[model samples]
Every structure is written in structure tokens, then in C-alpha cells.
Target: MKPVRRRIRRHFGLTAKQVAVRSKRPWYFQWGITVLYVVFGYGIAYWQFAGAEDVHQKLRQTALENQTLHTKIIQVERQLQIEQAAQTNLAQQLNKVQDENMHIKQDLVFYKNITNAKRLAK
Candidate 1:
């Protein structure tokens, strides 16, 4: 019984010591891991910055395109307004000409009736 207990204690003590030794790794290995982590972090930061810059450039391009389109739309709208105004003016002029033609036709009829009356009297 005593030998069995001693063997169990020795096994447990060796396990604890192994665990402690593994927990304390060499300084060079720890520094290498820290350097690798720093490099990886820097790489990630650079990748994010590059992506953001690309997005910014795209946004500027889109904004310029939008501004150009907006200006074109304004120009088109102004042209349409001018054309509509000209059409309205043309319609008014056409109405005035038709009214004048109607008046001339009435006068011609009156003159023909007067001439016919003079001929009948003779």
C-alpha cells in the first residue's frame, strides 16, 4: 500500500512540474511570437487602409458623375421650358391670324352684296 501511494504521488508531482516547465517557454520563442503578431496586425491595418482609400476614390468619382448628370438635367429642363414658351407664343399667333382671316371674309361678303344691289337698281 505504501509503495502504491508513493508511486501515485511521484506521478502527480512529475505532471505538475512538466506543466510548470511548459508554461515558462524560452524568451526567444515568446519574442518571435510577439513579432509575428505585430507583423500580422500591421498587415491587417494596411489592408483595411487600402480598402478604405479605394472606396474613397470610388465615392469621389461617383460624386463627380452625379454632379455632371445633375447639370445636364438642369440644362434639359431649361430647354424644355423655353420650347414650351415658344409653343405657347406660336399658338397665340395662329389664333390671331385666324381671327383676322374671319374678319376679312365678312368684309368681302358685304362688299359683294353692295355691288349686287347697285347692279339690280340699274
Candidate 2:
């Protein structure tokens, strides 16, 4: 039986030929695997970061929209209160006018009675 000697380049560590001889994978394939893993890691990070930014932007926009809607509601409420106050003032004025008309009618009736009595005396 012959004793097999370890090759001198094998002592320096694995050469491309040695790795191919042992694992049957080409050097380019190994580099491609490394690049693929790097690209996949970067892709995951990019999507996660981008999604977080999108959510944050939506939240900001929603807050602004909510503020705008709330201001509009406050404005509408104030307008309704002002309109209600005006209606109340107008109703009070109408009651005052009706009372004044009643007084005038009573005075006219009293004058008619006085004239009828004077004509009878004549």
C-alpha cells in the first residue's frame, strides 16, 4: 500500500481547486451565494423601513385631517348658537309688538264709547 502525501498548497489552506475537488461547488457559485444572502438581507431591511415610514406618514396625514374636521365642527356649532340666539331675540321682539297692538285697540274702543255718549246728549 502506498502512503499518500498531503499536497503543499493544501497546507496553505483551501485553494479553489481543492474546494471544488472536495465540495464540487464552483468558486463563482460560492460568491453568488454570498451576494444573494447580502441582497436578501438588504431587501428585508428596505421593506421594513419603508413600511414604517409609510405608516408614519399616514398617521401624520390622518392627524391633520382630524384637526381640520374638528375645527369645522366647532365653527358649525358656533354658527348654530348664534342663529339660535338671533331667533330668540326676534321672538321676544314679536311678543313686545303684539302687546303694543293690544293696548292701541283698547284705546280706540274707549274713544268710540265717549263719542256715542256725546251724540245722545245732543
Candidate 3:
């Protein structure tokens, strides 16, 4: 068979030595493009991190507000319970006073009836 290296060189019109030579311009240009891409990626990541931190702080403040509101509700309910108990006690005392007033009226009527009967007999 014909030599393989000679066959490949003839087909592409390039000697092996020419294919191995590297140019400086394209190599440096590729490195500059890569650096720009890295800087852009880092800037985007930093902005996203800042936004996340702001959201986290707002959530923390909202949670604290929720806890404060819950405590206020509990305290108000306790005060309402105390007021209701005082109202119940006042109602019971008013009923007892009315019962005592009814008994005093009955005793006055019985004493008047007995004194009238003794005067009629005389």
C-alpha cells in the first residue's frame, strides 16, 4: 500500500509540520472572551444573593409582627373573661337583696293583722 502519511497529506493539501504550528492571536482572543464571561457570571450571582438576603429580612420582620399580634389577642380575651365574671357576681348580689326586701314586707302585713283583731275584741 502507498504510505499512509503521504496519502493523508495529499488529500488535505497540508504537511504534518503545518498542522502542528499554533497562532498567538486567536489563543489570546479566546482567553480575553473567557475572562469577560467569568466577570459577568459573578456579577449576576452577587445581585441574586443580595435580593435573597432582603427577602429573608422582610420575612423575619413579618414573623415577629405575627407573634406580637397573637399575644395581644390573648391578653384581650383574658380581660374580657374577668369582666364577665364581675358582671355575674353583681347579678347574684342584686337577686339576694330583692329576696330580703320581699320577706320584710310579708312580716309587716302579719303584725298589722294581729293588732287589728285585738282592738275589735275590746
Candidate 4:
């Protein structure tokens, strides 16, 4: 029984309770390290926010450029529509002139035939 108890105690690490000892450091040194960590963290946060502001500014500039391009596209489409309409009107006018020229040629040919017949009969 005694051997069994000794083995259990050794295996379980319950032979004795050990206390840990630590050397105390000065409070000022701890406070100084804490302040330095806080200042460093704050500086990093400020830098990140400054970079974000630049990114936001660039995003706004790009948006403005996109809007300008969209406006120009609309203007160009309107001009194209106007030019197409003018071309259609010009084509219609040319067709009308061709038809008028064909009729005038037919009349001239008829007049020439009549004059030639009269001369041959005389």
C-alpha cells in the first residue's frame, strides 16, 4: 500500500507544492513602455487614415472623369443621329432629281421625233 501511494504521488506531481518567485521591476519603466506602445499604435492608425483619405480623393476624381466621359458619349450619339438624318434627306433629294431628269429626257426625244417627221414630209 505504501509503495502504491508513493508511486501515485510521484506520477501525479503532488509530492509538494512549489511557489514561483519573480523580481519586481520599477513602475516608471512599465508605464514608459506602455506609453511608447500607445504612441506607436496611434501613429500607425494616423498614417492608415491619411492613406485612406488619398484613396477616397482618387475615387472621387475617377468618378468625375467617368461622368464627363458619359456626357461626351451622349453628345456624340446626338451628333451621329443628326448626321444620319441629313444623309437620308440628301438621298431623298437626289432620287427626286433623277426622276425629274428622266422625264425631261423623254420629252426632248418626243420633240426631236416630231420635228424630224415634219422636215421629211416637206
Best by lDDT: 4
Give the Å shift of residue 56 in candidate 4.
Answer: 1.2
What residue runs in model 2 are displaced by over 4 Å at the alpha carbon? Answer: 1-48
Assess the local accuracy of residue 82 in candidate 3 as a C-alpha lDDT between 0 and 100: 97
Please state the error at residue 121 of candidate 4 in Å. 2.0
* Model 3, span 1-122: residue lDDT tens: 56886787776755544456666688779999999999999999999998999999999999999999999999999999999999999999989998988988888898888899899989
lDDT of 4 by residue, 8-118 (tens): 777666675576799888999999999999999999999999899899999999999999999999999999999999999999999999999999999999999999999
- Please tell me which model should have the higher lDDT, number 3 or number 4: 4
**Candidate ranking (lDDT, best to worst):** 4, 1, 3, 2
The CA lDDT of each predicted structure is 0.94, 0.89, 0.89, 0.95
lDDT by residue (1-122, candidate 2, tens digit) is 12233455555536625434465889999999999999999999999998998999999999999999999999999999999999999999999999999999999999999999899999
* C-alpha RMSD by candidate, in order: 8.5, 14.3, 10.7, 6.2
Candidate 2 contains a number of clashing pairs equal to 0
Looking at candidate 2, what is the lDDT of residue 18? 43
Sequence-dependent TM-score of model 1: 0.58
Instruction: Give per-residue lDDT, candidate 1, residue 40.
Output: 100
Show the lowest summed lDDT stretch of 10 residues, model 3: 13-22
